[model samples]
Target: MPFIPTLTLKDRLPRPFKIRWLRELMDLVDELYFEYGIVHQDIAGRNLFISDTTGSILLCDFAFSAQIGTVRHGQSVYLGEIPRCNDVKGTMFFLYYLITRDPQYSRYLLSDVDENTIMDRPKWVKHAGVELDYDVDTFYNELMAWVRKRRDSPKLAHYTLAPRHFEIPDPPEDGMEGWYLGRSHTMREMEAGRTTLSWERPPASKWDKSRKLLATGKYADERPPVRLMHVPDPKKGFPQMGMTNAALRGQDKRKQTQDVVGTEDEAEASKRRREEADE
Candidate 1:
């Protein structure tokens, strides 16, 4: 096996966060579901690694990965066939946590909290003084927008299970809404003025094979051979790193909350404590 040394997105933070990178990561998720019929089942910053050399993101830790149209324990299972999942899998607040780095929000999402409770922004968000509602709304809007773009893309015509095309499941008679489920109107509205980010495919190189050999102790020398390979320029097809117009508008709308909401520092500190405890 090749020695793939990488750093999780969490470790690379404190630097500027790029919306395009997030879009690319979401694209990977869409590809896994639509093209490969695989559901990662775990989408978190810790599970996503960034290649140090290539600067491209990689999804890892597939212990919980599942496939559509598969039989498991004498039961048929199909995930992402429609909006809303029967099983609650994957890091529920991954995108929200990634953006806000707020432990409170993460904790709330991971718990068996009611959807209505979450939607009641004033009870929690206002009390915490965080613009979580705006953050979550923006994240979902962007995600749905990306899904719509990919579903309509001519290049992805081979994919039969596009998310945008997923049949919206019948609403629960119990009046409980599954926010995870996709809606056609939501997808369409998100795609109205959105543009998909471009990505360049990396060229094939011998660096991986060389790394494997070195890892297996095939070389007698203490020092491994230095190899130079072309690393794809990430900026070539990626959007510029900065906030977009929509984000700016959101910021403007939440200006009041921004002044009063200072939970970001607490969130960062909480995250650090958790990391330390784990260590």
Candidate 2:
């Protein structure tokens, strides 16, 4: 897939981001969850990118994406008996981290860090270097509002069902039961105590003077001993460079045949000359 050049949010570590960018990221995360029913379990500053051209924020790294209420590994829980880790909660923490630049709470596991704890806080204290287009409170309010709206929804929001379901097929049975060490032995051959040739690994490439020179970048200054002439193969049906359609059609049958024979002979001679030079 084609992608615009971008820098990760973490890459801008010491540099503060704008409030608008955070809001844009929030909208993108909301869309991923509510609209697409995808939970990007692994949401972090490293996964988010800022476009180099537009300076817009983009949430990425969907390797840990899962359906709303599906069960993953033991580390996380979005739904079921103990619903702990989720995108909404993750977004809240991520936004808090962006504003405050305090990674104290985020150091803990997802299930251990509670979003409500951050939400109940009186105010978010911005770091000395942290700068924003708007007041820290403004960004906080926007984030809180989104969190409230998400929390109001059903816990197990299985609204969107998969369009199609597919069962993982079993592995195909292998036909070469007696094939071992790159050698195939049929049932009859094995019963008759027949032996198969063992395959040897290819020898490592040896560095010749020319190869060493090329590897060390010394070959760039050297020119070829002989200048090569590009010989066009007529079998590929390439049009003659200077021949017009009218000129070609105007040629007599005998002359056209002679031209073809001349081209073939010249090609053969060139091949022989190349072989002799190589020898």
Candidate 3:
């Protein structure tokens, strides 16, 4: 088998470059969960790879990967159904350990860390004699949001709207019976049978170009005038010294006549030279 080229995210310092890499890594994870219903289950620095040519992030080490709502051995798994696993099977805490190198923070991953415990408290880690500040609460919130979304749980919220001080919203009493599945739900579905709430108007229909133009305030109902300056016409032949089309046509005819006369003169001179040689 041919070897595939990949670069691991290990050994890279937590600078701006690595920070951007992590952001892209998270984007890849989001895409996988939302589009493919596949969870990496082992998202860490070493398991991720950056393609040398495309610069796209890749997730490897699928030993712990789980597929939701997929088929196995001719059995179809329904949507929102998850396989049971006794132990936790992800390397998310390894990401924090890589940044802080603190065992305390690593152990905190075993239990839920609330925002009250970390809002005013900032964890400090020393790297190369430089002290870096880590916001433990923000990290925990983001991690929880990511996990819940990957699992297709109804409790997942927008990243910006992730609960900071309070626990995430719980699934309905019916166990997601009427709850919309997947990463997101349409506004119509979210606001079903809600008469008190005011709904914002949806955008113009895609097929309605006039409405789109009106909405954007860039209506161009009339065609713009064409500007005629320094434009060449190949069918009229080359323009001679800024001459117009009529003048260019006259010049071309004259040039062609001159060339025909010159060819006849050359042929007559050759006949005279041959006669003289015969004499």
Candidate 4:
């Protein structure tokens, strides 16, 4: 619930306290994802907070929770097809334009949580040959190391995310490909507060040009003071402002097709996901 606009804190802190606070909050998040099998897709600035008292940081933003095994096109599929993280924009992560599979990685890589009924694991993983009592701390350390190595990485940098004490990502086998399940189709949740909620879009929803608002006969026209512009005003406000049921009904369809066609941005995200999976 803490909005970033109202607060400011040090992104760079001393290693000792930073590591302590990070690890503590990480334990809670790891448990939630692995034990409960819930994926917190929003893992960056908007969803993070530091406690003034304990100097602890916690992850928030439940907007992207989804069930295990649910599949959508081009969404990042971490291990066992569990969601990793969502692209901050249409199909990319923040800072780096990558499709991520956060839930899958958190669930399987962390200690104790397993899809294997051997505690709850997939047969494929068992076939890959893993052992019990895996120390997740090592895994976390490695990931952190990777993040450090590629400090300025945009995406695909997660591949070497850190120096792993042990490898959690299974070796990729021939003909074994992974895919992501994008947002749920026809789900009203995907449509609500879309333009407004996004932080990546400059000026955000305030910029009427960013979104081509189909004017509803019943709706009044009142543009905000200043906003980011996404689309060119060919016909300007009056003509661009019209809306119809047909225009809205096929939103999911449009999105799916867009994923298939893949703009330069989407292509970049796909490339990042592929590299992560390959590594």
TM-score versus the correct structure, for each prediction: 0.39, 0.51, 0.35, 0.28
Residue 173 in model 1: lDDT: 43
* Candidate with more favorable, higher TM-score: 1 or 4: 1
- Candidate 1 off by > 4 Å: 11-14, 73-92, 105-141, 147-279
When sorted by lDDT, best at the front, the candidate numbers are: 2, 1, 3, 4
Candidate lDDT (C-alpha), each: 0.49, 0.63, 0.46, 0.37
RMSD of each: 31.0, 18.1, 21.8, 28.1
**Residue lDDT tens for model 3, 192-245:** 754453334344553355443543334447456898887444333223333345
Error of 2 at 62 (Å): 1.2
Clashes of each: 2, 0, 0, 27
Q: What tens digits encode model 4's per-residue C-alpha lDDT throughout 93-159? A: 2111111223343222223232222211121131112222333343335334443433343332232
Candidate 1, poorest ten consecutive residues by summed lDDT: 82-91
Given candidate 1, what's the lDDT at residue 98? 60
Model 4 per-residue lDDT at 17: 29
After superposing candidate 2, which stretches have Cα over 4 Å from the reference? 1-5, 13-16, 71-82, 121-123, 159-279
Report the Cα lDDT for candidate 2. Answer: 0.63
Q: Candidate 1, residues 89-111: lDDT per residue as tens digits? A: 23235554565555665444222
Model 4 spans with C-alpha error above 4 angstroms? 1-17, 70-279
Estimate the overall C-alpha local distance difference test score of candidate 1: 0.49
Error in Å for residue 229 of model 4: 36
